[model samples]
Target: MSATTLPIPTDAGDLPGLLWLPEDRDEPVPGLVVLQEIFGLSEYVQQRCADLAALGCAVLAPQLFARLDPPVAGIEDGDDVEAWLAEGMELTSRLPWERAEADAIAALGALRAHGAVDQERVGLLGFCYGGGLAVAAAASAEEEDRPPSALISYYGSALPTLLERAARVEVPSLHHFGTADAFIPSQTVEEIREAVTAGGTREQVRFELHEGAGHAFDNPHPALHHAAASEAAWRLTAGFLAETLFPRS
Candidate 1:
């Protein structure tokens, strides 16, 4: 469980990122680029990265909020979610979506280039805002023949805006959403499902809906967390990543 700050070179500039490597690493392992939620790389995100490492992965999380004049890495659980949301929206408002998209791709490049990773087996896992960005990154990668091996998106807030591109996501992917998500209603979820699976390869793209869970239900914060749904989603994510990125050889 070694965590260190690493610089990731992107077209935009050098982006500060957190790198987590599993201990007792005697060999290269699959890698993952974890995109942050609206709150940035908060403790919950770091914990998620550590969880992935425990499952045998090298994880890199780019600090997207670094583009701000005074970088905002993450917010504490005690911080007001509404205030943080407002601040996050303002921060992203200042940054262009294209630049954010580029930074995400660069994150994949960084993971691929890292000596401890099996370049061919890197995946992208994004939550909330990042989930949408992940779709864009994965789409661009597929277009360039450097697509992620797998993608896991959890209630991507920008899914609607990125649907046109997300529909083009051609990798083994899994999407998790709460049927009761206020931000993205169930209706939109159905639309997303239709668009992404329009090509008739349903087996390759899967979507799971938790009956009454809300957005960010996996967050440990009591207000946003749904214990049962979170546990089920985690189990599904772990199995999905394993089956897609590290198939039995």
Candidate 2:
């Protein structure tokens, strides 16, 4: 699947994004707005967009780290994982949470407006930092009467602070977490699951916990990757999206 660079309009300016469309563009398909991790729109993220497109959805991932001086795009976890992680964290710190949330919502709007997308069937997916931002966008969208049809979040780092809002997210949602995540405790993950699932229909929320897996288990980096966990999470995510947005009659 080939991806094209496009500009997503935002209040600040045009946010660069990678767009992937399904091969059968004769009809508009479900659209998905993907949020980038702290490392920016790395190869892993772009590949995920392609995977989503292959699964019969249009995907767009905006550059949330574009606020940085040099505009970080893609950074791999080199030999010095700590150094790269720190660089990514620094880039994330420079971006205000409010602005990042707005940018994410803007990306969703752009995807919803695209001619190749089924606006009523659009959704949002994000990882780590983007995961948290997705939650904020969901809340905003709900208030604006433009909520996504579904949401997928992987180990949202700021979920603890957004629990109240999460409880109000009525859309079908799938969340992935690691039991051994050093940054977020297992107890916290449990709390997040409870909060996000609260007040929703019985089948509206799903949480998958990977045993023995740490943070960023899907990154494919030796320091963080867990093949088993990543595969399981992807399977769950793919099934969830298919059922929620492309149900078979």
Error of 1 at 194 (Å): 0.7
CA lDDT, every model vs. true structure: 0.89, 0.89
The best candidate by TM-score is 2
Error of 1 at 47 (Å): 0.6
TM-score of each: 0.96, 0.96
In terms of lDDT, the poorest run of 10 residues in model 1 is 194-203
Per-residue lDDT of 160-236 in model 1, one digit per residue for the tens? 87779998887899999998899898888988888777655667998999888999999888878999899999999
- Where model 2 places Cα greater than 4 Å from the true spot, the runs are 199-202
Candidate 2: TM-score? 0.96
